[model samples]
Target: MVARPDLTAWRPAVAGVAEVLHAHFTDHVYPMHAHGTWTLLIVDDGMVRYDLDRHEHGALSDLVTLLPPHVPHNGCPVTPRGFRKRVLYLDADVLGEEHIGRAVDGPALDDPLLRRRIHQLHTVLAERGEDLEAESRLSLICERLLGHLGRRVPPPPSRPDRSGLARRLRDLLDERVLEGLTLQEAAGLLHAHPTHLVRAFSREFGIAPHQYLTACRVDRARRLLLEGQPAHAVAAGTGFCDQSHLARNFKRIVGAGPGWYARAVREPASRS
Candidate 1:
């Protein structure tokens, strides 16, 4: 599935957390596409049928459907009422600052605590509904999410090729993110096809190339902002079109606006 790219967008403040739309989507379905973060789907009402990788899971309320990043899959409604759900894009290892590519997948769906933590994060997102502190609230949720998943979320993968590819991608983007490199470019660097790259990248890193790229830009921008760089400068340096462009995509992926992230990260430093 192609990402929605043509519209003007803004990041809702999310502390260190980000989320997509939160609504009751009925009969709506997604084709195979990739996302930037781990998605925790809770069936609030009716049922949905989805295939995660090869495992076909029948969706039900109170059951959290976890999609580890980058693995391609699709879903449809088992009931006409469809489903109510939300997606959080970032979690509070403060957005994987310390070698995120190091985060490797060990086992999928064996951890129940990760599910519960994501549910809590979802609750905060669902309840906040775009308030000023909504982001900090979400960050708290993310902190909890990571803390809970720390042990449960599979330890980072150890293969050199896997981590090496991730690091290389980040470095390449860092040189010039504005070139708008496609997944094909990444796959070529790894000597893999786009589809295979999607599967392999997701399986190893928990997100696809596109999502991984976005996260790298966002994190770099975050560090720059903490240095008191102007939003526009940081955005440009990080490979977004401009400040507004960066802010929109940043919020879309990180779940918090640029201004909010900078201020929140700065206040504490100023205090100390």
Candidate 2:
């Protein structure tokens, strides 16, 4: 087969995600190198064999491989068909320095839920106006990864009611709905860890913070659209990055696109 390597890499606006890369490589071998950020990888089409900290690992389609920051690793395809993979380069702060040794010890995870969550995170990160969603997804992914690495400590037996914290987060999200809010910003303002904030909000509200924010935006967009505002303007006025972003969320929540919803509201039905 001909040697052709396809790759796309971009830095998202989300805080923890340093970079996102999707690649399909044939006959391309990666030399031993280290990164300043965590490498979270998933193989889509084929397998990748890599060595991390003098031990070998395989990145299979079902596995979520996490190569810790500052750890040396090299990768190459397992077959002539090569490998197709998606990767997320996360900032060191996401996982902390304490987990690097554990990750280096066992870089590949066999958990299906983790692999699925990572996939969902990649999908959210690829979108322009989905920073909040990306942050939420990344938080869960990191939490699961920490669990996999045995870095997560169990909470105390006494469980305090975090409903107040969740309400505060909801209020903050409401105050900044139009301006947009990041998970880190919310965590800082609420004086809670990102994962804790996410858990609290989800548990109290029965919905993820990102989902709540999107619903709010969509509701606002509906009002604006009915008030004779164009779909594009409604998008900009309601915190969406663009008309398409608004359309995607609007359709999901409202069962129709912004333009269609607006038109349906304005147009009178024919008399029988």
Candidate 3:
């Protein structure tokens, strides 16, 4: 079969996701390049052959191809007619490195139901549907993928230390840093006393809960900025009160303001 011409389109970031790409490739081969975000991919037609961490992987339409952030991988079609694929580049920090590590161990997931659900979520996102509905689907998709990958989600603190209340609190902070959650609220949800929870968290992590939440927010803002989002918008999107608020925290944590960080991150790509 004669190969079709290549086509590609990039969509702007949504929520904690950095960007989406829908592309069709014929003879095109991606060189050795790795994304700064997790590459969650769907092959719509034909197959994609790629190498992750020196191991080759061939993914058909039934499977989802997951490449963890900063891991080297490259791709090309396995068939002459080539392939059509959609990709979601998600902020790595939002997903947590430990969970990503589990997926990286086995990058291709052969779950048809999960694939369909992810495709549906992608459709809603690409079409820019209702914000609440999209958010709901995104949450469900994350939960399903985490479970499918055999990574355990922490149960609420049966005993704080054994259950790792601090770790669970860290996950909670990452999830709601942008949306904002208070110490009292988080403690209530975890069934712990607020002051005790605070002390436990500090003792375990060496940083106050509020400080950790701020750091998470700053990290998220950095990803958005890297995606070319303006500082003001990033501030609002990442749960800061305003652009100035983002600037203050971002400079303190990141050693630069959001604008500078954005330019620094994008300049290499722009030059190339």
Candidate 4:
């Protein structure tokens, strides 16, 4: 087997991102290994075969691969000259816990719009550092991805089942947000299917479980920030991946960065 110019490296600029890889292999086969972060891959050329949760997945060129954290998978080419692939390793915390089950169940997605956005994110991240534009693009990518992977809602039933399941899920989330509970864990504990659980929770609570968790983390971070904790310190306490992750979610939820929000809180108390 002849060697080809295969590139595997990291992109340092993006927050909550672990690495970037571009490679074309003729004989290399990735052994079964699991990453703790989300693996978003775009096939640039040829075809590749892999397995997720003991299910085989074959991805052609231009298709997107969304591998959830802690799933053991392996990969090799399906074509003669091997395949070309680009991948982004993203912190699982940034994507939240609700969609992890869907990603694990269906690693190869056929959404063209999602494929395009992921490719665009890769392009932008490769070229420049983290800025407003890059951040905006990342947000959009996540939004579209969540739409695909989140719970599916059908027509509203005349009387929605008010089983109080959503409330129970919310309580569970409130208690477990700092512990980083995954959708599978929650569903197993509740003795329900993950999709049904998500749909019911979203229908009753007006948001998915992961969204509620993020809000809980952000809300906790706010109180901590007001208590004079630094952003980095607050991040760890609130279960954020890092300060950047905290800052991004905090600014989005609070409309200001932690430092600024802290100042605003302090000024009001000082003036009082």
Q: What digit string (tens of lDDT, one per residue) describes model 4 on residues 211-249?
A: 678788999999898889888999999988788878887
RMSD values for the candidates in order, in angstroms, are 14.5, 2.6, 15.6, 10.2
Specify the poorest-scoring 10-residue window by lDDT in model 4: 127-136
Give the lDDT ranking, best first.
2, 4, 3, 1
Candidate 3 wrongly placed segments (more than 4 Å):
1-13, 154-272
Model 2 per-residue lDDT at 130 = 93
* Leading candidate by lDDT: 2
Whole-model Cα lDDT per candidate?
0.57, 0.88, 0.73, 0.75
The residue-level lDDT of candidate 3 at 69 comes to 87
| TM-scores vs. true structure, each candidate | 0.39, 0.93, 0.54, 0.54
For model 1, the stretches where C-alpha displacement exceeds 4 angstroms are 1-10, 91-140, 147-272
Tens digit per residue, CA lDDT, model 1, 33-53: 756666556655677776665
Off by over 4 Å in 4: 151-272
RMSD of 3: 15.6
